[model samples]
Structures are given as C-alpha cells and as structure tokens.
Target: MTDDQYVAFGLSPTSGKPEMLNSDIVVAYYDKDDGSFHAVDYSVTARSQCDGTYGMCPDERVNGRNDASVIGGERRNGVTSITFSRPYETNDQLDMPISRYSDPITVIAAIGHLNTRKEANYHDDFVTKSNVVLDFTSSEGNSCSTLVGGGQETPRYLPWPANIIPRGTTNFTATIGPTGGERGYSALTRLADSPSWGLAWWINDLLIPEIYVERGQTYYFTVYGGNDHLNSARYHPLYITSSPEGGFRQKTVDEQNREQVFAGVSYSKMGMPEPTAVGDMCEWRHTAMDAWEDSLTFEEYKDTLYKKCDGDLAGSLVWTVETETPDLVYYQCYSHRNFGWKIHVVDSGRKERQEGNNRGSTLLPTPLLASLLLATTRLLR
Candidate 1:
C-alpha cells in the first residue's frame, strides 16, 4: 500500500499557474501487516503555464531531491493518519522556504489515490483551495503581532480582552510563586483581565487568573514553576481536570478507595521515570489517566504534546484543543487542590465578529489587515 497515496501543498491555490513554481508534495505508503504508514519521499514541482489540470510538472532543478521524513503513522478504523516533519528552510531552490516570522501563508492541498499498477493516480476530487491561510509560527493566537521582514524579532503579545475570544496557536508562560500568601500556578505572560480597565498589569503571578482558550487551536504552556526554589513543583505539579475541586486523593467510599480525580489531557515527563509508566514512583493514577492511555497507540503516545516535569527546573505542557474538550475545566495541582485556576474552552469563529468590533480606530481590523499584509508580502517575494 505504498503507492498512490500522497498530499501536496502548493504556494498558489491554483495548481496549474505560473506561481506553482516551488510547490511541495509528500508521497506516503502504508504497511498492512503492522497497520502503519510512512512518508517515503517528497517532490518539488513547477508549472510555467496552465495545463487544464490541477497538476504541476516536477521541477528539474531538484528532481531527485527528497527532504521529507516520516515521524510516525498509524491506520485504524479505515482512517489513515501520518505524522511527518520537514525543515522550514531547506535551502533548495525548487522548494518554498517557509518563514518563521512571516504573515500567514496561503497554500493549496490535494490528495491522490492508487492505480491498477499500484502507482499513484491523479486526484479527481480530493483537493482543497480554501481562502483560509495557516500561520505555523503563531504561538499567541491571532491577536499577537508578528514581525514582518526576516529579523529574529519575537512576536509582540497583545492583551486579550474579555469580550474577544482567542483563536489559532496560543502560548502561555507558567510560573509557580506565592499568590495571596499561597503557592499557586500563575501565568507570567498573560495579562490579568480587568473589567474596569479592559486589561490590568502584566505578570499575573499574583492573580492565579483563569485561562480562556479556543477550540481547534494548539496551546503551549512553558512551565517554570518546576524550577522554582526548594523544588515546589514536586508537590504542586499542575494538571487540567473536569472537577473544580481536585480529586487527586479523594475517596469514593468510606471503606476503601484509591481513585484520583483527573480529566482532559494530563501531563507527563519527556524522558526516563515516565509519569505514566506503571509501578513508577511518579506514576499518575486516575480514571482519566487510564482513558488517556487506552486512547493512544504507542506511536501517538510518543508524539503526544501533553508533558510535565515534577522536580525538574523547567518543563512544558502542550495541548492541541479539540471539540471533545469540556467547556469548563480547571488547572489544579496534582498533589494538592486550589493551586491553579479555571480553563474555559470556546469554539472557533465565535470570536471573529467580537474581535472586529473591539478594534481601535488607529489600527486596521484583523481580517483586512491580514489580507493587505499577505498580498503585500507575496508581491515583495
């Protein structure tokens, strides 16, 4: 099953246009015995003129070059999923260089099938030419201002108002410190929400603020609490849960119970002494932990974004929010309660109109500004 299955990304939505000079296509094959897939190779193509079909001829400059590599893959329930990685800048003239700090990039996607000879066939109807663009480096949602040009400038964080919800990839820096005389998980990068002022001072280390995140977006929480003095993180490891009052050591019956309360995606460390390993000292025992383990394959577990470190100086927890995420969840300590805050999950596209209404007169609206910037950037390229 290693033939005729592929995904293509073109710089231009139109496949047979002159702008399709450096489009990238990844070809994959499947293994029936192991129920796994592999991205075998990639091709850089070009089309100097329209060919009346949605196909571009391979560019001769890099005809035999292969830069794509398979990370992991699996096929189950008739659905095949493959995870692959490629460099943002491959330095190949026939390939498009993805900028780390540039504006959103517009591209086309297509899929192909197998032929009678077990070779890749033409894609009849499996193509997507939507207007939506993707920003791979967007770590602070749509509100964060990205640096243009090609300098190594960090993205400027914009205050997220209460009324305006967040969308796209969001980042949060987590720190452990004394809040109201009690040690709690605080978001150092997120500004505290103030109803009267619309936004409060930065470094919300004292507020223990509730986090609002949108569905269908990726979130990265850089946890510095583990590196705090006296290794406070060893006892206050943060976790997301459905229960407002954490049930880490709660009893269900008066006689005997070892049930721990945990919900959603929990945390795990990167290397040895894995938190999920059975019989390990740092093992996480909970109902949700069992569910999380059962839901993932070995490959999926290896590539999971959920991460945590108990006594390490620094760590991170990443969660790609899905529709199944509960509307209300709490971020509480694994060993203790009330050390974290609420996490509100909102649906996508619900905040577009609200964000438009909240824009200032001096600044252009997000949609308009994005379009203008994208067009300008493309012309300059």
Candidate 2:
C-alpha cells in the first residue's frame, strides 16, 4: 500500500509506552542500482480534533511496519515523497546494511501529529522529527539522486557536515548506541535509565558523532560502551558531564542523582570522597585519584571526576581539557538525560597562538634590530 508512504507512527513498544499515536519515522532508503541503503520502521495513527479541525483529521492509512522493503509515495504540494527497496543483505533481523564506506549511517526521526480532532491524545512528539545521513559515497550524483523522497516531513535538524575535532584533541572515542527513541529521547537515549536504555557520544567511531575542542587544548575521551547493535547485553553505567547548556533533561529521581548538578558543581557538599558501596551500583572509578573532590563519591564522582566508564571510557580514563571549560561542553549521562555529548570548546589553540605572537611582534624591526633599538633609546634618555 503506497500513498506517499513515510509513516513513522507512535513508537514505544518496549515500555516507554505510548505506542500507536505516532513517533519514530526513520527511513533512509537509498539503492542506486545496488549501492544500497535501507533502514525503515513505521506506524502512525492520527486524530487530534476531526470534528473541529486544528490539524484536520484523516486521509488515513499510515500503518506500515517491521523492517525493509516495498514502499512508495507521492503527495505533491503539501509534500510527501517516498520510495523503498531493501537488500544489501537482509533477513530482516531489524536490518542495518548498506555496506562499504563505513561511517555516516545515523538517521533518527520522530513525528506524531494531531493538533485537534477533539483531541483524544497523540503527541508525545519526540521533539518533532529530523535526522539525515544517506550518503552512499557521493561522488556528487545518484545516492538516491537529490534525495527528498518519502511523504516529506522529516526535518528538525539536518545539517551534518562538520567534524571540527582538530587542534590537538587526541584520539578520542565516544561510542554508545541504540536510540530509536523510548529512552530519554536522546543525548544518545535517555528516559533516565529505564530498563537500561541507551545514549551516545560518537566521534572517531562516528555513528552519532559530535565533539570539537580547542581552548588550551588537552582533551581525551574514550567512552565506547559497546555497540554493533546491542553488544551482548550492553552493560550500561556510562558517564561524562559538562553543560553550559547543550543538553540536560533528567526530569527526576533526583534528576538521576543530580550527578553534581550536571557539572555546575555541588558534589554532596564538597568534602569529596564517597564511592565504595559495591552492592547497589556505585563504585567503578578507574582512577582520578580520590576522584577530585566536591564530596566526590557516586563511585567517586562518576568514576574519577566525571569520566565514568565500565565497558569503554577506554583505558586509563584519559581526560584533561579543563581550564574552567564550558563553551558548550555537555558529555552527559548521569542516569541518562538523553545520554550525552555536545562538547564544543574552541579558543582555536589560543587564537592561533595569539596570531603568531602578534605576527612576531610587528615585524619590520630587523635593520640590525632597528639599529640596536634606536641606540638603546638615546642612551636611555
């Protein structure tokens, strides 16, 4: 059935509840005569006020479902473009394969429309849909050629073309995954931590990437908590925090134990030292020596002053970039406020080393050093 099919209906099937009202439309289908790219999921129900008219009820049929293949669309003017075909390898084990070219496959979307049909309910609206990355090695043409397909309405952010981590930011690695939504809606995935959800921080390993830094340069982040889709029961507990405001929505459970109010500071009243209670989950500091105060201990401040890693913050924890840090620094995830990472701190190597020492002190002073500095300023006047 195809009437411009791009249905991403009300998702939450694993108990974030709210199923079938609409939300979760992430379709990235690209198959330029077999270069391949297909990852689809759908289900959409609507009726906010049909008897009155706010979003204007029904032309209804959005009920597509479960993994890869055979969907097509076209709605024109009001916009709705869709086309589908799947198989770069698919037995549909929740599908994910468009092989070769490695990194660039992240495309998460959300949509649950209904402004009024007498409003029976349908809008937990996961911040209104938008995520794009369907590049199958673009030599400039045909990667789904100009791509605007699928009942068109998937845009809330789309601007992926900036890596920025260059200026001495070391081999950083932040990879965590699985967020079709239902977790906290994303810092990577958070609903706090509900049944161990997911969250992310992917730079260098790519996937959900973002982490650019400079300001006095000394950054290091490893945090790869396992992901190849699910990494065998993925041992969650991950951590990293900073926020001048780029991420933070914990909502409660003491905002997921406050985690020192998300790095603004207040670690249990600053006497620093408290994580050794191994039976209720809070003791995994790899080492930051007594974990840098502020009353330390939620496992010594999320394992050594907010670097927290059990599966992969990656060897020796490694983190330095902090001269007071905060150009936007949110590598978050206490219990999950959407998981974590906004990290953008630029001074650009202290403004290109103060513009090369002010262009080497205003040049032109070399005529024998300006005649010995004007004969030592007239013998020091």
Candidate 3:
C-alpha cells in the first residue's frame, strides 16, 4: 500500500457501533506494481493523541492478523473497484463474525491516502455521513438502507438537478407545519403518542425538498412559526449539519456523542453580537405577532431585531457558503430527529454557467414546469 489510495470498511459486531477503535474492519487497496488488489485486517486499539489533546489526531493502529482474501479488483478511469470475501465465522478475536440469520449489521466506509511509508493517513471528512445497515437474510436479497430517524415515513422526493437553487441572497419563507402534503402535524401527534415519532421541515411551498446550493452564495431563511402558524414550528429550530437525517439524535451512543456541528458560514460567524433567543438565529417575533412584518427584508431584520431577539416562536438563519464547505450537508431541526432534508453544494462556476444558459428564457422548460406544477398540486391536496 505504498503511497496508494485505499478504501476501508469498518464492521460493527453490534447493530449501531460504527467507530473503528476496538472494532473489526477491513482495508482494501489496489497494488499498481503487481496489478492486483490487496485486503488487510485492522483493529484500532486506541484513538491517536497529539500534544496532550485526545481527539482529532492522526491514524494510529495495532494491526490484526490478515484473514480476508481478495477475489479481484481493477483500476480504470481514476476509479478503483475491488471485490473481496471473508469467513462468516472467523474465531479470531479481532474478526467480527457475520451471521446470515442474524439481524442487520452496521457498516462504516471511508477512503484516504497512504503516506510514503505506506502508513494509512487520516480521512479528512472522506467518510460516509451515516452508518448503513446491511441485511443478509432478506428474502429480497442483499440490501442496504439508511435507518430512518423518528419513525417518520421516508421522504418522497428524490434529489434532482433541475430543482436546484442558484447562488445569491435567496430568501426562503420557512414554516413548520406537517411534513409537506399532510393535513396536520401528524409526526408531532405520533410523537406525543409514541416517543419515536420524528419531525419534518417545510421550506417555501415544498415539504423537506432536497435543496441544491452553490458555494460562495448567500441564503436567507425567513422563518415563520409564530402564533399565526403551526405551533410545531415554534419548537423546531433549524440548523445545518454535515450528517444526514439530522445528526442531532442518532441511534448509537458513540454517534450521539460525536459533534455534528457545522459552524462554517453560520449565524454565529455573521456578527449576531448576541446569543440567539432559542438556538442559532433570532426569533421572528418575541412578543406580538404583528411586531415583525413579512415585508421586512433580511438586512432590516438583521440590523434591528436580530441582536435582541429571544424565544422560539420563529427565527431566521443565514448561511454564506464557502468554497471549502462540504459537498453534502443537511438542514435539520436542532431539537428533533429527521426534520430536514439534504443540501448539495456545487461549484459556483458550474451554477453560474447553468444560470447564464437559462438567461435566454424567463420560464422553465414546458415538461419540467408541468412536472413541478403537478407535484405542487398533489402536495397541496
């Protein structure tokens, strides 16, 4: 693995443990000199430490005896593909047994480079956002799925490029009601009935739409969860996270302890000069509903009422995407689970080119417009 790129898969013997330390994992890489794939067994005994600090350190390892065999692999077009197999029951303490009749297993996958000395380096955010569960005994065959949070139904819309929001100081009229298309706050009611019910977000007119944004652009989310609107919005404070399905509350204890905070280009960095009344942004109205009008611009709200704002009735969040921002992020309710959707960050140059090409036409293409309209009508009903 000298100076070669590699992919590692960490398997948790338990259902929800995805951490590498004290767990069984397999690392695979392509050997360019031999023109073959290689797999190594590894188990991290302790997290790396530096300068008396205990966390966020480099890769440290206590190698395990090799037990995996590579079936085949190849490198083509800058992509490395590999296939490997291991015993379902390796009696070695470092090897976690895979039972075909057992429950689903959690898997964490990551990619990173190796130094000149062939030592694996740290993966700087080049990892899966959430642990994926794999079912071995499913009648439907080997299948993988994300563990949906809050027991809420899966989001209906798939992430589509045509639904992208271009760069600029775009304003979003944010509200909290039912997950889009529902008649009431069913999730909240379900949660009241059972603690497992999750929350959801409704942005503008869409229910938890997977939004695509451009780096170096600004977004102004004008939230409205006052007395005039649904009470659910009052308790749902929106925040951005690098983890999907709202990393606020995860299934595993280790994951729950991990910091899911994404502090880049946030309200705190924007010189709020005061703590938010609730969580990240200023409340829409601290007292009377009529105190703040919908006609007020983001700048106006920021300059006057933002600093003194307090309470959870409603609020606004401003994000200025930086170039180094992760390609994928999520806008989630701070206090609940799975209440938001994915935000895909794209290069500003690419978005600018798309916008320029569309400048000739003020309207969307007929087919796209019709599809959007139909979706809106269905959601409204």
- 226-272: candidate 3 lDDT, tens digit per residue: 33112222344566777554424222446544645553223346533
Models 1 onward score TM values of: 0.30, 0.25, 0.33
Where does candidate 3 clash, by residue pair? 277-310, 284-314
Q: What is the lDDT of residue 228 in candidate 3?
A: 17
lDDT of 1 by residue, 56-109 (tens): 323332244556678987654444566777678877654667789977777666
Candidate 2, which segments miss by more than 4 Å at Cα? 1-7, 10-16, 19-71, 75-78, 83-381
Per-residue C-alpha lDDT of model 2 across residues 55-131, encoded as one tens digit per residue: 11232222223454546644445444456654444443323445557555444343332111111122233332343
Alpha-carbon local distance difference test for all models: 0.42, 0.35, 0.49
Best by lDDT: 3
**Candidate 3, residue 153: how far the Cα is off, in Å:** 34
Predictions: Cα RMSD each: 26.4, 20.2, 18.1
Q: Can you give the lDDT of residue 343 in candidate 3?
A: 74
| C-alpha lDDT (0 to 100) for residue 358 of candidate 2 | 11
TM-score of 3: 0.33
